[model samples]
Target: MSQPTIRALILDDYAHNAFREAHIERPQPQAHEVLVRVVASGVNPIDYKIRSGNAPYAMPELPAILGTDMAGVIEAVGADIKHLAVGDEVYGMVGGVRGLPGSLAEYLAVDADLVARKPKNLGFREAAAIPLVFLTAWEGLVDRAHVQAGQKVLVHGGAGGVGHMAVQIARALGAEVFATVSPGKRSIVEGYGATAIDYRDEPVAQYVNQHTGGKGFDVIYDTVGGQSLDDSFAAIRLYGHVASCAAFGTHNLATGSLRSATLSGIFVLLPMLTGVGRKHHAEILGYATRLIEEGKVKPLMHPQRFSLGEARQAHDAVEQGTGIGKVVIDIA
Candidate 1:
């Protein structure tokens, strides 16, 4: 049999521009891998940052494919893979960087450890929107902070991709969730079962005192880092836990230290970048599927659709901050 050719969105170099209709070599599954026919791909800010040469960690080899999250059906399973069989619907953050093939292609040969059964309640596009953001939120809130019921939790940037997911996850976990957003997004943030605080008009200290009676939040999750991370240090109560996925700045930890609060930083790309702890990511996806099926967790997807050929536009949408929710590329 002749090798098959696949249509993929390939990123040739680090620039704001990307090209579509690139023919790439299709890959067969390794013994522990499964071949997936990609149905949808999710776009993130990191995708565009890497495209523009802003993120050093996303250094894909030249002429690479650009994507991170995807949902699809299994076409074939490798000999050693036991959990999945052909025709199983699945989703995961497969690749697009670090020498691995991404989900922008019509097909992907990914390790079984990097994927999970898609939620029975979600379509391919919705499922594609969950893996990366949900996994990042889960690891920070559940795995790192160990958030418990009745605890007062505050999430920065509650209207963003990771922030929205974090708010929902914390609410589902029984925390008294509070989220910071702009005035225009109050209802959107509150709809996720969190009290919305307008970060623009309200000072962090004021909100902290108002909500927690000056005790401060028991848990603070920072999705928007830098200045927000520093504010989290001051807003957390004594012995409180703070988790941040985007902590990028040089700042004094004096506030947190004075309050005796603990801080943890989450970097969700480690597994895909170094190939370590890959199974844990799959396990989290499995949990997310269960949550979605139970109607406890739901992804907020943008209404617009983009074909694989319009990948550049999809990247631009995320970069321009025009997407209300996750920006997805439909690959039929």
Candidate 2:
């Protein structure tokens, strides 16, 4: 009997910025996995970073199928998977890091613990856009900071991928949300019920004083690292919490320490790399599904569309920061 092969985009070299069309044998589900027929694949900045061999921490081996987020239909279920069945629509940041295969293919065998049922309100493309960015935001805001009602929350880089999700999640948690953005992109954050602060026009101290009465925010989510993380320490209230996904590089914690603020670093890829917290990823996505179906959260998608054959263009869109919102490639 001949093995059934599925169409896919394979990356043979990390030196190039393109994918090659190829057909590979379809994967079958393991006892804890599910076979998914991929419908859409979300493109993140990390995708390009890994492709160019820049993200060494989570980079896959060469000649890999590289994609992290996916929306799809379950075609087969493993014996241990009870909550999900064949034919269920699901979405998650399943793979594309280290030893796992990614979603840039017609079919994927993903661990059952890494996915949740797709939000009833969103189509495949929209659902695909939600996983990586949403997971990153939720891990920082809900898991680490424990955001609560009436708290003041600030999201740095609110117009970017993880930043936008942080803004919406904070708003949905009943926090008085504020987002820092460029002047022209103010509306992007404002439309999500966040007070937009023009970071370029106003210095960190000025905005902290103006919006927070100089007491500083109760919680700060810093999506942009480097100087932004430093600014977060200066802008956090005494005893407040600050969570950052991009907390790389040397930083002085003197400001935060002076205020007695709590700082947490979020590395969302750790679960995929170490396999220590895969179930938590599914739980977070389950919460996202409920929030999305209730109309409290939704994904912002780019205007331009790309087919599976145009995967290169999708990576380019994310890498160049040309997409107004999340860029996705239709796989099915």
Candidate 3:
């Protein structure tokens, strides 16, 4: 008898190298893991960064499969996996980081605690897109900022991946959501129930005075870094909370200190990189499933489609910013 093999795209080296297809031995579930027959893979900015060797912190070693988010059906459950079964549909930001295999293969042996039930209202592609960005948004707004009802919440880059999710989640949490977006993408953020501010047209001080009466927002989520993160500090209310997923750069905190505002830096991949907080990712995804079913959240998908072979183009779409919504690769 021979062991079964699965088809996968492997990256031999970094520096903008392309993925090549190969047949590798199929992975079996170890304890506390599950074998998922991945149907769709979601491509995030991190995906491209890892592929190009820019994200050294999360980059896997060479000859590695690389994908971060996926939605699929469970093929086999490992020991002590009581919450999921062999046939359950699931979605999560499971792997593709250092010390873990990715979802670019036909089958993935993923941590059982990192995934949750797929939303009944969403297909595998849509469900795949929800995990990473949704987790990032929820971790910042709910866990870090503790957003409250009737509070004013502003999302920097509200039309982008994490920004859009923050807008929707904040609105669902009963906050008055405002998002800074380009003029053309005003409809995109507005459709998610956020009031869109043209960040280019209106200066921070001007919009702050007009929309908030110079008081600033109660909560601000900055997905756009650099100047946008700096603007967040200047635009936050006294004693407000500012959460940033893109706070990787250096910035002065004098304004925030003067306002007595709390600043939270979010690195969504920390759980995947480290062994801690893996279950919390699943719990957050569980909340996302309920929110989706309740009609309070949904993924905005790009019109373009890519097969597993076209994964390079998918990464290109995200890296080049050519797509209007989440880019996904249909793998099954």
Q: What is the C-alpha local distance difference test score of candidate 2?
A: 0.94
Off by over 4 Å in 2: none
> How does model 3 fare in lDDT?
0.94
TM-score: the better of candidates 2 and 3: 3
lDDT of 3 by residue, 1-332 (tens): 77799999999989657899999999989999999999999999999899888998999978899999999999999998999999999999998989888889999999998999999999999998999999999999999999999999999999899998999999999999999999989999989988889988899999899889999999999999999999999999999999999999999999998999999999999999998999999999999999999999988999899999999999999999977999999999
Tens digits of per-residue lDDT, candidate 1, 242-332, equal 9999887787999999999989999898899998999999999988998899998888889999998788889899999976989999997
Worst 10 residues of 3 by lDDT: 11-20
Q: Which window of 10 residues has the lowest lDDT sum in candidate 1?
A: 12-21
Q: In model 1, what lDDT does residue 246 have?
A: 87
- For lDDT, candidate 1 versus 3, the one ahead is 3
Q: lDDT of each structure?
A: 0.90, 0.94, 0.94
The total number of steric clashes, by the backbone 3 Å criterion, in model 3 comes to: 0
Return the lDDT, model 1, position 202.
Answer: 93
Candidate 3: residue 318 Cα off by (Å): 0.3
